[model samples]
Target chain A: MRAIFLREFFGYFRTPVAWVFLSVFLIASVGVPWFLGNFFESNDASLRIFFRFIPWIYLFLIPAVGMRLWSEEKKSGTLELLLTYPVSLGQAVLAKFLAGWLFIGLALLLTAGMPLTVAYLGDPDWGTVASGYLGAFLVAGAFLGICSACSSLTANSVISFVLGLMCCLLLVLLGWNVFGDLLLSLNFPVPLVDFLASFGVLPRFNPMVDGIVAFADLVYFVSISIFALCFNRVVLHR
Target chain B: MSAPHSTARIEANGLSKSFGEIQAVRNVSFSVNPGEVVGFIGPNGAGKSTTLRMLTGFLRPSEGSASIAGIDVLKHPIQARLRFGYLPETGPLYGEMTVVEFLRFVAGARRIRSVELDGDLIRVRKVCHLEKVWHQTIETLSKGYRQRVGLAQAIIHDPDCLILDEPTDGLDPNQKQEVRDLVNEMAAEKAILLSTHILEELEAVCSRVILLHQGEILLDESLEAMRKRHPLFGSVKIRVAPADADRSLSVFGKLEPFVERIDRQGDHFLLRSRDKRNVSDAVLAVSKDAGLALLEVAPVIPRLEEVFQELTRPQSKFIEEQG
Candidate 1:
């Protein structure tokens, strides 16, 4: 398991995908706050603006990091070799998922300079800033798990990327006003509407960014990640 | 159940796999003992790869099971896999990594520690003749060198068994000979199963041959036994005088016990005999009775190609019904 982790971790740098993902993520996370959100003016005690945009940022970058996780192995026919090793399918999936998630986490850490600068320039709510980073990490982990599962189901990296994006988009759309309004007009039961709303990205993620570590929310994201990873193992075994 | 300790390095019993409606392998079974080189020969899409995959536990068999070094592969695949090294057809290499780096990865995967890493790497590099190209990236190396790198990784763990698929594919004649020599040297201790389309390679390297076709084992025998079972009798060419032709033909008819069949062309007789050992005795008897001189008796050895063709010929309805 350790060997697989090291190989996969270093393998990220051997290809252009990791670098491209990091660069794009750093530029977007940092650049968007300065150019679009006007980080210096009307600054609150919180890094609310940056946290607000992370879901959109991860919508693009997480798939890029996860698309090649298993799909490349299938494409190159190395999955056979990998499976033949003395490693269990669960261990293999965990190693790959952790490697990709850690890569994105590293990129996110590099962008910490933004919040540090915000603190240096004006008083900022360090708790919200820290919670926001934690939320981003959890969201990235959840999306990465989904993308890794998608990658395992196909040999084409492009198909995996597109499917991952679609899945993430659907999850986000579940929280939108348009979806809720449509559900209200359809006269759906109140419980069903509330249940569907809980399925959305914001309902679960917004609490984490506000420093509220609700057990249900934590379970929701962790469950999704575990479920996706286990699904990946099943597909590879089949 | 724990496997009984034995010299056998690999064993399979009625292993089978099916992909939807197609049966890729059906009750295929064989074994390789330590220090023995076995050749697997079959036509394209004949389940050689599928069988190898099952042995390595890459694909779960739909029925039956396999084992490596007494470890049940399906029940404990990781344990079985730890005892064997495999080289898939395409060599399954990371093109971006240097040859040395790839070896290091394999060594680490096999759980070789830093203390033993240098020695293991040196041993594998020396055996595979890969020292010169160690620092070069795999993508930049030629196909032959890449294959060498693949071989290096396979042996890096010092497995008790090695399963190689087309080990000599895409190599020049000289490179092929080098690999053959390396395989020969390694065969002294490791149980090796190699699949190849090249018949001569089997003759040169393998002690036994397993001929497969349509997911069935057509033949399994030692090289010497196979040769003896289908021995190539020498062709006897005799030019007889027209007056003595009838007598010579009569003598040839008496020689049917020693000969497979005979063909006639004018006054010439071409006799294909099964008794290559007593060729001179048969020729002497025919010469004395027919008053015809023994012109030529040359031995035509049968090549493995001819043996393979004859063994794998499509079965007719009569043969199928009998089975």
Candidate 2:
């Protein structure tokens, strides 16, 4: 399992995918806040505007990183080789997921320079910044888990990417008013809509930006990761 | 064929597998003992790969069991997996990694660590002749080198058994011979089962063969026994003087019990018998009596390709019933 983790963790950098994902993400996460959110004009110490753009960024970029997790193995026929090993399926899935999660963590880590620049400019609330990063990490983990499961469903990387993108798009849409109204107008039940909306990351993520780390919010995101990974295991089992 | 003895290293007991409405393998069972090399031959989609997958525990059998070194593959897959190495179809590998990294990763997965791991890697690299491309990335190497690396990883642990699915699928003739040599070199100490559609491959490697067709075991016996199943198992050829050929043919026409079909070639007479019989002496006796000058006379050995077609042509069972 350790060998798999090391291989997958380093696997990101072996291709152009990692560098492209990192550079794009670093530029967008830092650039969005300054150009569109008016980071300098607001004259604020908090990184709330920066944290807000993270989910939008993750909604697009997380799938790109996670799409190759199982799809490539399936395409190259290595999935059979890996499953036949002495390692259990769960262990293999966990190792791969953690490798991808940590890769997103690294991408998140590279954006830390923004906070340092904020601190240099004004009196930044370091706790809020820390909690915000944690929120972003959890969201990344949840989205990555969904994408990894999507990758396990198909051998074609393009189909895997599209499926992951659609799933992540639905999760993000569950919290927004326009999507909620659209579902309600389609004669959806109120309680079911409320239950679905509770699974959305933005609802749980909004408070963490103000340094409010609710245990329920953490549980929700963690459950999403576990559920998605469990789904991945079940698909491979079939 | 009868089941192998209890000491067999790799065994499958009444294995069956199905995909939805279609059955891929049915009630198939065989075994390979130590120092035995078994060739598995079948056309595409004949469940050859399916059976190998079940034995390796890559696919669970729908209604059967497999064991490696006496451990049940389904019940205790890891233990069974530890006793044998499998090279799956396509020789799947991570092409991004160098040959060294690939072998080391496989060794680590198999729990061969520390100093022992290094030595095993070197040993396999030497045996597989992969020393030239040890540090080269797999994608940069040719298919032949990649296949050698595949074989190297399968044998790195030195397991008691080896299961190779089309180990030399796409290699040139020389590369194919090299892979065969590696398998033959290791055949003396391990139980080996390899699948191929090429009949001539069995000549250099396999002691026995299991012929599968449409998800059933049609034939499983010694290579010699399979050849004996050829329609013209004991055919004979006699090169005679053209002037005496007609008289020789008339003489052979009376040997009704020995000759099934007699064909006249330019200066030769080809005789196929209903059963295996010594017709060479009969021909010589007839030639002497008929005053024919016999240039050459010898028994004809059946070719593997002809024998394979005889046993496994489409609707072979129908052909068998008629025969």
TM-score winner:
2
Q: What does DockQ give for each predicted structure?
A: 0.66, 0.68
Model 2 lDDT tens row, B1-323: 11243344889899999999999999999999889999999888999999999999989899999998888988998777777888999899999999999888888888786779889988998899998999998999888888888888788888888999999988999999999998898898889999998888998899999999889998889998787776666788888877776778788887668888998877787888766765777777876777779888888887888777766686655347335
Q: Give the C-alpha interface root-mean-square deviation per candidate.
A: 1.1, 1.0
Look at candidate 1 and tell me the lDDT of residue B318.
24
**Least accurate 10 contiguous residues by lDDT in model 2 chain A:** A172-181
TM-scores of all candidate predictions against the true structure: 0.91, 0.93
Tens digit per residue, CA lDDT, model 2, A187-224: 99999888888867788998999899999999989999
**Candidate 2: where is the Cα deviation over 4 Å?**
A177-193, B1-8, B250-261, B281-292, B317-323
The alpha-carbon deviation from the true structure for residue A110 of candidate 2, after best TM-score superposition, in angstroms, is 0.9
Per-residue lDDT, model 1, residue B237, is: 65
Error of 2 at B178 (Å): 0.8
Chain A TM-score for candidate 2 is 0.94
The lDDT, on a scale of 0 to 1, for candidate 2 is 0.88
lDDT (C-alpha, whole model) for all candidates: 0.82, 0.88
